[model samples]
Target chain A: MNSEQQNATLRKMAQLMRDGLKTQTEPFPETEKEFAAILEELRRLDPGDLEGKMVISGFVDHPYGPDRQRCMECMYYLVHRQWCDLPELAVPVEADWWCRLWRI
Target chain B: MANLLWLQGGACSGNTMSFLNAEEPSACDLVTDFGINVLWHPSLGLELGENLQKMLLALTSGQMPLDIFVFEGTVVNAPNGTGEWNRFAGRPMRDWVTDLCKVANFVVAVGDCATWGGIPATAPNPTESEGLQFLKRDHGGYLGKDFKSKAGLPVINIPGCPAHPDWITQIVVAVATGRGGELSLDEFQRPKTFFTSFTQTGCTRNMHFAYKVSATEFGQRKGCLFYDLGCRGPMTHSPCNRILWNRQSSKTRAGMPCMGCTEPEFPFFDLAPGTVFKTQTVMGVPKDMPTGVDKTGYIKLTAAAKAASPRWAEEDIFVV
Candidate 1:
């Protein structure tokens, strides 16, 4: 997407999380099978269902867990674009954001 | 002229098909140019029935000089180890392999099956199949560890799902031309010339790998396959990228993950569910790190690589 569209979407995501979106951030997918199941749920959502995608993927604005794992180090995160490159969750995200699909 | 005999055990003839497709010193070149006398082969042999047994007996009985013995497929020893399960010519194939290895000057194992038992030797191996000199990572297989060819060398293993065509023909030519004694072998008895490098040595996606950009799906031009697609290129030893399959492309170049077929523990994890194409991770960290790399170092490197990755690294640069 263009820079303007990406920034607008990023603002929408930030606003949702700030308003207490209460996403399913616990029960982090421990294996590829579980991770794939989460992707499948996201795939079934409407293309514009931003909140549904966030809830299914367990996205949080801040880093999660003892290790403080975040999108910055995840293999799928595109740092320059500030995006998750995972085909199932191609969305704008902050470097500090944590998701159940996070992997190094 | 060097007398070469080719045999098959519990194999699918995949290696034979690959051997026939050899380009750099074609199978026909082995006969016409390299002076390798084709005594017998599963596909090209003219002998059949009693005639085939007569030729085999001649080689085993010291009546004819056996220069190079190339073996494809695993040595099957099932059904109470009598080897009655896979009989060729007149007796069991394993018995033939045993006798042939003793008489042959150089023994060359042509595929993963003949080198490390391949897929047949995976977990619950009912066929009781084993390679000539190895059963998976173990040292001894059907042949004892001390067993050597008449030339006093252990079985030279040219391993792959089906070994690269050029590797098979080139090694055969080297042995036929009396360079077999000069060949250097690794711990696994594989020729070091081909097995010394990783499949990622010349991969086109190395920039992506360095930048920690991952190709989440297959056939994507941008991003490396290792992070998400379970690519074994960084760990598996082979000249796949350096030599190039089909003289133009390799598995990694074509965007398919390297399956680590050259390693003894092939069909890794016994083809278990959810393990084939998906990178196995523990607590979001790769289970198998790049060769010689530690978990702490890998995490640190990933952080730095992502931070330094250029904007173009995230885009499809390989435009058709």
Candidate 2:
């Protein structure tokens, strides 16, 4: 995305987190099948439902869990772009931010 | 001239097809240039019926000196180990293999089936298929571990789904040209020259791998297959990238994940659904790390590599 558009999307995501969007965060997908099911759910949502994508993916503005899991260490995180590269969950994210979809 | 006899057991003749396609020292070159006398091959042999039986008997009886005995596919031991499932001429094929190896100067196993039991030896292996000297990772297959040819060498294994055409012909040529003693074999009995190197050694997507840019999906030219797709190139040993398949591209270069076909545990996960193409991960981390790398090291490396990844790495790096 262009810098300005990316910034706008990032602000939108940050606002959702600040508003305490009650996302499905407890049940972390431990297997690919479970992981795929989450992706399938995201795929089913309307592409314009950016907020729904954030909620379903369990996005948090700060690192989550005892391990401090964050997007910075995830394989799909594009450090330079400050974006999540997962095709299903493509979104602007922060370095220290996290989600249940976080993977190394 | 080295008298070479080629035989098949419980095989699909895939190795035979590969041998015919050899380019470096073509199959025809073995006869014309390398002085390898074609005694009898499943495809090239002229003998049929009784003549073939008589010729096999001659070799076993010390009448005809068996120089190079090449075996393809697994030795089937079925129906209570009677070997009745796959019979050659009057007796079982395993009997012929046993008899032939004893008399032959050199015994060479071609293909994963012959070297390490291939797909036939996968879980619930009803066919009772066994490699010549090793079955899966177990030592002592159809031939015991200590068994050797007249040349006092263990069975030389050239393993692959169907061994690379060049590896088969080159090894045959080497043995035929009297370099048999000089050829070194690894713990798996494969020639060290070819099986020692990893398939990822010269992969085109190595830059993507370093940057931790995952392909995520198939046929994407921008990312490494190892992260998302079950590309075993980093762990499996083979010169697939160096000696490119068809002389131009490899599985990784063509955007297909390396299936780890060269390894003994081929058709990994026993062709289980979802395990074939998708990377097996535990808690978002790869189950199979690169050779010599541990989980802690991988986590640290991924963090560093992804942090340092260039912007171009996230996009298509391949230019037309």
- Give the per-residue lDDT of model 1 (tens digit) for B271-317: 98889988998878989999999999999999999999999999999
Task: Specify the highest-DockQ model's number.
Answer: 1
DockQ of 1: 0.79
Per-residue CA lDDT of model 2 for B1-320, tens digit only, reads 99999999989999999999999989999999999999999999999999999999999999999999999999999968989999999999999999999999999999999998999989898989999999988999999999999998999999998899999999999998989999999999999999899999999999999999888877688889998888999999999999988899999999999999988889898988778888888888888899999999998898889878888888886879
- TM-score (chain A only) for the predictions, listed in order: 0.96, 0.96
Candidate 2: residue pairs that collide:
none
Quote the lDDT for B306 in model 2: 80
Local accuracy of candidate 1 as per-residue lDDT tens digits, A15-93: 9999999888878888777777788898899978989989988889998898899999999899988998888778999
Q: Each model's C-alpha lDDT?
A: 0.93, 0.91
Error of 2 at A97 (Å): 1.9
DockQ value of candidate 2: 0.70
lDDT of 2 by residue, A7-87 (tens): 999998888889988888858988788788898999999987898998899888888998888999988788888988888
Where model 2 places Cα greater than 4 Å from the true spot, the runs are A1-5
Task: Look at candidate 1 and tell me the lDDT of residue B290.
Answer: 94
